[model samples]
Target chain A: MARIIQCVPNFSEGRNKEIIEKIVEEVRIMEEVKLLDYSMDKDHNRTVVTFIGEPEKVILAAFNACKVASELIDMKNHTGEHPRMGATDVIPIIPISDVTMDECVQLSKELGERIGKELNIPVFLYEKSAQTSLRENLADVRRGQYEGMAEKLKDEMWKPDFGPANLNERAGVTAVGARMPLVAFNVNLGTDDINVAKNIAKGVRASSGGFKYCKALGIEIKERNIVQVSMNMVDYTKTPLYRVFDVIEREAKRYGVNVVGSEVVGLLPMAALIDVADYYLRLESFDHSQILEKRMFE
Target chain B: MARIIQCVPNFSEGRNKEIIEKIVEEVRIMEEVKLLDYSMDKDHNRTVVTFIGEPEKVILAAFNACKVASELIDMKNHTGEHPRMGATDVIPIIPISDVTMDECVQLSKELGERIGKELNIPVFLYEKSAQTSLRENLADVRRGQYEGMAEKLKDEMWKPDFGPANLNERAGVTAVGARMPLVAFNVNLGTDDINVAKNIAKGVRASSGGFKYCKALGIEIKERNIVQVSMNMVDYTKTPLYRVFDVIEREAKRYGVNVVGSEVVGLLPMAALIDVADYYLRLESFDHSQILEKRMFE
Candidate 1:
């Protein structure tokens, strides 16, 4: 079986169509890699490129795309609504199929080494690929962003895992790591009770002793007159979708609130959805191997 | 997005490894084609080769593999535990990604015509690609198998959708069609009573007024001392997995039987599983677009 891996790199230049096209063109040139999508957020001033292929091909494509982004983007003059630390802010490698997390961690390390050696940019490993406990959280590693990196790098604890200890004025620093597929799911409540939404979010997030893998926040969409329980499912396999949604439903019911609808922000593995179906359908024991498409992989 | 299609061709010479390898070798050479799996059942004397790729590439691979099978195998001497119709028994074209059933129907028809013209073998189009309503069911079309084909070909209704009106003694006849992804799912019952399994099958299959797209039968696995409810899910989208399994569970309760477990026999589209998950999880209006992997395609 071919080991398929996915790499999604976030570059700090989303407003320029010409630059985005050029960066994406590098990935398009690779015959083996399938470029899935690329989008830029003007307000955030960031561009995210999504692609999947064999592990080696994906890594090579990421390296090439990053190189192009570094050349065109100048972090010294970069400003955005979102936090940033580099021209190519963060590059995450996700294992899609027939590949393990450990392998992804190893791939991240290899890419980080190459970026440091070739581009002279600082590289920090986060999540599963982190070298130290402090660097495991991306937000922690990118605490000061680019502006504070010069003084921050002086501390031994803040030293990057790869590249020079000093900062690059043009490219800044990049965080590369491997992590489980995260599901950005949001549920809208029927009522405009922002407090109800906030309480539900607090009751269902990891920080508040809720579902272990869930990180949630409540946001009020003023125009829609609805409150949203926005969430990031970090480890779907462990908590699964059914469990999370059921808990949220139960919590909302206590507040006399009804869930109007839900949304998934991105792509999900087939297995995650099957598990939800199995539980809801009350299937005694359902294995995904029974699905016809899975047989094609056999 | 690339239009992905899958073709599974069942060929008649499973007992001979050399012939099976040579037949599959044709598809293996295609650069875009991914040969998912090939398994030979010695008792049935048949081999099922599963592969997927770009629509045109899959069609080409299927044509080449069938050509190889026709040259090496003679239907006159073929014997198997399972039903046989020709050197290549059945070739079903299934829509995988960014493709529609109508498009697959057109592709199947074109491919069937080419096989008839090029291979000089009678080709019957069944299921979605069938020209006539009577020919939609494969079993009805292949009533007598290879042994009965020569006589059956004489009738107007039995005339193939492609190739000559007469049968070829060597290759016999081939069944070609376009259809939805068929999931071979089986649920084992806790009891040894085959009647219970049969009753449950009747309650969950289309033939017996169950799910509209479900076809089910009861089989006894004597060695395991368990009765099985074997099912072919013709349209997972119309009749999702959770709905069908729930119906079976409800019906099984009437017979005082419990479903021991369920097994998925082959590859399944990720969407099918996701629907089940969404339903059970009560994730109102869940969309696969939220999956990170899917974002690559967008």
Candidate 2:
């Protein structure tokens, strides 16, 4: 099987279309890499580029793209609604096919070191690639953003995992890490009662006593007259989608509210959906290998 | 989007590894064509080669592989447990991505004409490419196999759809057609009672007035002491997998039997499984576009 990895790097400049285009163009030049998506948010002043390919090809494409972003984006002048600490910001490597999470972590560490040494940008490892537990959550490392990084660097505990403690006025610092595929799944309820949705969200999210890897928020789709329990399944393998849906269904039944429909916000691995089918359909022991198309990959 | 089509051709020369390898070698030479799978059955004396690519590239590879099969295989000395009609017995082109069934029908007709004109072997179009309703079912056209095909060729009703009416004593005749992706889905019963399995099959198959596109049969695995309801989902879009499993579950309940597990025999399109997930999860208006990986194709 071919080892496939995906990289989605968020850069701090979204309003400047020229710079975003220039940075994305670098990824398009790689023959083996497939550019999946690139979107700019003016409010956040961030551009997120998604691409996937063989591990090596993805790494090279990501390296080149980040290099261009670092050179063009000036964090000192950057202002956005979304949190940020660097020009390139956060580059996350996700294992898509035969590649494992451990391998992705290793790749992220190697890339983080190279960026620190070659690009002279301070690098902090977050998520699976973090060297310390304090640095695991990206929000923690980027708490003060670029402006406060200079003062934070004076403390040994706040020093970056890579490069000099001194902050780069232009590029700032970058977060490089590896993580499992995250699925953005949402369920809409039939009732217009936003409280019902909020209660359900409270009962099903990690912050409460719900699924461990699930982060959920209830929002009212006023136009549609429905309450939605939007969710981010950070670890689909451990929690699985069916369990979440079933729990919500059970929870909604308490208030006589029914689930109208569910939605998957973004791309998910085939394995994630197959598990749902297996459970709901009562398929005793279903495996992806049974699918003929997967046979081609084998 | 790129148009993608899959072709699986069964040739009658499995025991001879050299001949099988030579024939498969032709398919491997085509650029942009993916040779997904090729397997030989010694007892059946047959080899099924699966491949996919652009329509033109698939056709080129199919033709080249057929030419090699015809050269090495002789009908006079052939014997197999499975049915056989020619050196290259059957070729079915299936639309995989960004392609329609109507387009596949056109491609099948064009390929049929070329095979007859260039190879001089009798060809009959079955399934979606069948000119007449009676010829649509492959079993009807391939009846009596190779030995009886020569005599059947004399009948006006049995005239070849393409090529000479006369059969090649060695190559016999070939069946070419277009069809939807066939999903071989099997559900295992909890009990060891074979009759219970047989009864469940009758209640869930098209011929038995179950699901329209489902073809089901009951089989016993003597060694495992288990019975299975083997099914072929002819058109998954019309008769989705979740519906079929549910119907079987309902019917099995009558016989005091429960579904142990289900097995997907071969490859299935990712969309098919996603449909099951959406339906079972009560997902409203879900689109594959939401998948981040799908953006790679864009």
Candidate 3:
């Protein structure tokens, strides 16, 4: 089986179409890399570009995109609701198939070093690629956003993992890491009362004492005239999609509301869906090897 | 996306290990062709080889295997539990992914014509590749088997779709067709009471006015100490695996017997399992395109 890794890089510039296109073009131009999706959130002023390929090709494509981001984006002048640290905010490599997390972590570190040395960007390895336990969480590594970053770097523990011990004035710093594939899923409700959606979201998200890896929010989709429970399943392997959906459905019924429909916003790992299949079918000894298309991928 | 077609060719030789190996080797060595499985049923004296690849490669590999089967086995001397017509009895091309049934039908015709013209084998196109309404069923095409094929072919309605109107005494006749992916699935019952299994099988099979595309049987698995409702889901898209399993489960409950477990005998299309997920999760607006591994397969 071929080693497949996915790279999702978030860039600071979202509203500027031309800049966003230029940054995304790096991934598109890479021979083996597939630019699965790239979307700009004007409100957040951030763009997330998702792509996948062999580890080497993916790292190269990601590095090229980071270089483009560094050249075009100015972190000092950037403003967004989401947390930020650099022109290219964060680049996480996720092992998609036949690739071990250790290998992806190694790839992430190498990619981080290359970006730091060649592009002269300050790098911090977070998540699975973090060198210290204290840096394991991305939020901890990125605690001080761009403006606060210059002062935070002066601390002994906050020394940059690579490149200069200081942040680049214009390009700023970047967080490079390895992570599990996250599924962005949303389910619409029949009720216009956003409280039901909010209550359900709170009951299903990780922080609110629910599923371990689910992060959720209640949002009003005015155009649809309905409320939605938007979620990011951080680790679908642990907290299954079906369980979360089932809870939301059950919670909706308590408020005398029915689930209108549900949708996955972006690509999701196939194994997550296969888990649901195994659960419902009560299949004994079912394997992905039974999937003809899976062998074709290898 | 690459167009994938699966070809499962059945040979009349099974007990002869050397001969079965030679026949399957043709597909094993073909470039871009994946020989997923090849098994010999000694009781039936038949060998079935399953392989998949691009349409052209699969057809070429299947044709090569058929050539090997024709040269090694003589139909008149062949004796087996299973019905037979030729050394290579039947070849069915099934669309796996990114390929349509119409395209598979076209491929089947091309393969049938090539086999007829090159090997001097009388080819009857059955199922979706049938030239007439009367030829659409495989059992109808091979009604007489090898013993009576010579006289059957002489009749106007029984004229072969390709090759000479007369059957070759040594090789007999071959049935070629395009078909949907078939899942060889069996569900075991907690009770060894064969009658309960038999009755449940009748209620779950098409012949007994159950699911439209399901063919089923009840058999005792002596070694396993249980009875099984064995099924061949002819068209998973038309008659999904989960729906049939639900029926069998419900039927088994009526007999006060529980479903012990279920298994898929060989490779199955991924979409078949995904359909189960969609049903149980009650996922709306779900698309196969959202599957990351599916994109990798393409």
Candidate 4:
């Protein structure tokens, strides 16, 4: 089976329809890569594009899109609610199937180099592709945004991983990295009691010393008359959805509440759900080859 | 999304490798169709080929393979342990994704008619595509093996659904139909007592007033020193695997036996596993669109 990877890139100038279309066209024209989704946030002034394919094709699509962004988007005139650093702000390569983090890391570096050398956009390899611990966190690497990027790059520790050590006036700088696929999962409580949901969230979140890869919070669904423990499952392969769900159920029971239902906010890899079934059904010696649809690739 | 369907066809003269290859090559040559598997049993003197693709492509592949079988396989000279009726013995069309049973039934009829008129092979539309209640069961349609089929066709009740009432001299006759995808699932018991497994199998089988789409039996696994309730879940959309699993787990507790684990013996539709996860997790408002890989079709 071919290794599949997903690339989600955020680019500046989402408010300009013509410019966003021009950048997105690069990815759309690639027959080998599927453009899963692309949405422009007017407030944030950024367009997030999601696409997946074989590793090589996905990287090519990301590179082509970034090149278009560099030529079309001028970060010097960019302003939005969200922080910015370049025309193509950030590109994160996520392993979807038959792929590993190390492979994704290498892919990110290759993409970064192409965008930097060919497109002339300075690239910072953050997250799993980071060369230094400080740069591992995207927030730290993107701290100064576009305005402060030129001055920050002058510092010896803040040198760009690829391209010129200085920033580009028009395209600014790009953050390219590898990361685990994130799943937005929310479990609802039977009752409207906010406290029950809050406690459950605290018990399953990493910040509160719960599941190491979970980031969770309590939220109210006023229309449904229920409270939910919403979570960002950063690494389901390590901290599976079923484990967190079982914990939340037990935690909610203490508050005299039952789990109403759970929701997966957006698209998630099939492996994430397969893990849940494997745990609950006690499926033994099951593998991807046993999935009838997986035979399509062959 | 394209409507995908699976076709499994069995043919006579499995002992001849050249003949089997000629038949399978027709399907393998179809660029749009994927041949999932094909195996020949020397003892049974039969070969079963599995393939899937969009409805039209799958039907075309099946036709091409059957055409090759009709030309090369002489059923008069065939002898097999397994029951036989024609060179291309049987063709079962199964809905896999973005498809309904009604659509599959129609596709089977279309394929059957083509085989009858174009190949001059008498066709019996059994199972879901059966024109009469008596023909609904494949066993009834194939009551007489190839040797007895010519005499059986003389009866008005056994008249072919398509083609001349008389069987083709070389090809004999074929049974083409639509049916639900079958999943082979088995639940293992902790104890070695075979009776415990037998009782659980009886409680969850359709014949014993259990789930409507399930067929089950008990068997002892000598290697594991355990007994198992093996089942054929005929229609998971109606009789879900999780419900049958939960029932077996509960039933085992009465005999002081615990469910050690369960196994899915062969390839199963992804929806079967997805439904299991949805039920166990109490997932709400989930749809196939939320599955990342499903987006590939779009």
DockQ of every candidate structure: 0.45, 0.58, 0.60, 0.77
Query: What is the per-residue lDDT of model 4 for residues B1-298, given as tens digits with 9 covering 90 to 100?
Result: 2357899999997799999999999888897688988999999999999998878999999999999999999988998899999999999999988889999999999999999999999999999999999999988888878989999999999989888889798999999999999999999999889999888899999998999999999999999999999999999999999999999999999898889999998888888999999999899989977877777654
Task: Write the residue-wise lDDT of candidate 2 on A165-219 in tens digits.
Answer: 7898889999999999899999899899999999999998989988899999999
Query: Which RMSD does model 2 reach against the true structure?
Result: 2.4
* TM-score versus the correct structure, for each prediction: 0.85, 0.93, 0.88, 0.98
lDDT tens readout by residue for model 4, A38-114: 89999999999999877898899899888888888888899999988998999999998779999999999999999
Query: Once superposed on the true structure, which residue ranges of model 1 sit more than 4 Å away at CA?
Result: A12-24, A36-46, A77-82, A189-195, A219-227, A255-260, A278-298, B14-17, B37-46, B76-85, B144-150, B188-198, B217-228, B252-261, B282-298
Question: Can you rank all candidates by DockQ, best first?
Answer: 4, 3, 2, 1
Sort the predicted structures by TM-score, highest score first: 4, 2, 3, 1
* Highest TM-score model number: 4
What lDDT would candidate 2 get against the real structure? 0.86
lDDT of each: 0.85, 0.86, 0.89, 0.91
RMSD of each: 3.7, 2.4, 3.4, 1.2
- Quote the chain B TM-score of every prediction: 0.84, 0.89, 0.85, 0.97
What alpha-carbon RMSD in Å does predicted model 3 have with respect to the real structure?
3.4
Q: Which 10 consecutive residues of model 1 chain A have the lowest summed lDDT?
A: A289-298
Q: In candidate 1, what are the lDDT values of residues A1-298, reduced to their tens digit?
A: 2457888999999899999999999899986688888889999999989888778989999999989989999999999988999998999999876678999999999999999989999899999999888989999999998899889888988888899989988999999999988878888888898998899999989999898999999999899999989999988888787787887788899988888777777677655666766665455555555544444333
Which 10-residue window of candidate 3 chain B scores lowest in summed lDDT?
B289-298
Taking all chains together, the TM-score of candidate 3 against the true structure is 0.88
> How many clashing residue pairs, candidate 1?
27
Sliding window of 10 residues with minimal summed lDDT for model 4 chain B: B289-298
lDDT of 3 by residue, B1-298 (tens): 3578899999998899999999999998998888888889998889999888888999999999999888999988899899889998999999988788999999989989988999999999999999899999888888889999999998999988888788888888999999999899999899889999899889989888999999999999999889999999999999999999999999999989999888888788878888888887667788888878666546
Model 3 ranges off by over 4 Å: A12-26, A29-31, A40-46, A67-83, A117-120, A168-171, A189-193, A219-227, A253-257, B13-25, B40-46, B68-81, B169-171, B188-196, B218-228, B252-261
Pairs of residues at least 3 apart in sequence or in different chains that clash in candidate 3? none
